[model samples]
Target: MTQQPAADPFPPPSAPPAQQFAVPPPSPSGRWQPERVDPLPGTEFGLVQLRVMPITSGLAIGSLIAGIGSILVSFLVLCFGITGADSGWGGWVSGAFTLLSVVFGAGAVVLGLVARRQIRRSGHTGQVRFTGGGMAISGLVCGCAGAGIALLSLALALVLQVSS
Candidate 1:
């Protein structure tokens, strides 16, 4: 025995054929209407545009690292008194390390300035959303402090020599 197709269980008594299952009209703007902006090539979805963006600053990071390292080195020199005048050879070694710290600090400040300049340029071009300007500035501050400390140490050394 073959089974026949079943009719609607509860069809409206006076409903017209076309209006029986009518779909609502589309709105003026469709649900997923994309903006009028032109889509970038190779993208199937026009909702988002892709572009290369710059963010990280290598120079700024280097500056921060160098500046902090210089401070740490100087602090170690002070803590250990590795350059104590008592030891003839230790004094020269300590002075050299202190000088190195000063140089590192200066380099950090210079690199930080360069990074900041690049960040500013990138910002103007709208290529970078965020920048490491704070890091660069902080590095500059540390560098100056390190240089100042070194100069003070040198001055004290000279004063002690004159006193003796």
Candidate 2:
């Protein structure tokens, strides 16, 4: 004999097909429900925290110091000029100032070269953010100032003029 069709062929009609969306924690209204979603894929984001922000901070600092040193040398040069005219120990003082100027100038040049190298490196690595370039430029200023002062002082003291 053929069997009769069951009252409900489908599984006892359980809760709505495993709702992709799940019910939210019961709200005061008792009807709150939340929808499910998957996290965004492929698209990603990154931040450049710069563990050490490495554009040779010391080089920039050295450049800045050198620039300021140049201004100091210029002042010393003026002093040397005034002192050298009087002769005696004044000449000695002038010589000292001139020497100081030369030293400071050379230091600034060295620092500038270093800073320029750093700037190049930073641009290559893409980390430097704010002040290295400015400092390096200042170093150039310092070098020029120091050289001018020292040379001018030397010329005055030794009469190295072209004698035109």
Collision count of model 2: 0
Give lDDT per model, in order. Answer: 0.65, 0.60
lDDT of 2 by residue, 21-111 (tens): 2332345764333333332233232222222234445776786687677668667666665555555344556567777777777787788
Return the clash pairs for model 1, or none. none
Error of 2 at 50 (Å): 6.2
Segments in model 2 whose C-alpha atoms lie over 4 Å from true places = 1-56, 123-131, 158-164
Model 1 compared with the native: what TM-score? 0.60
Q: Report the alpha-carbon TM-score of model 2 versus the true structure.
A: 0.55
Best by TM-score: 1
Worst 10 residues of 1 by lDDT: 43-52
The TM-scores of all predictions, comma-separated, are 0.60, 0.55
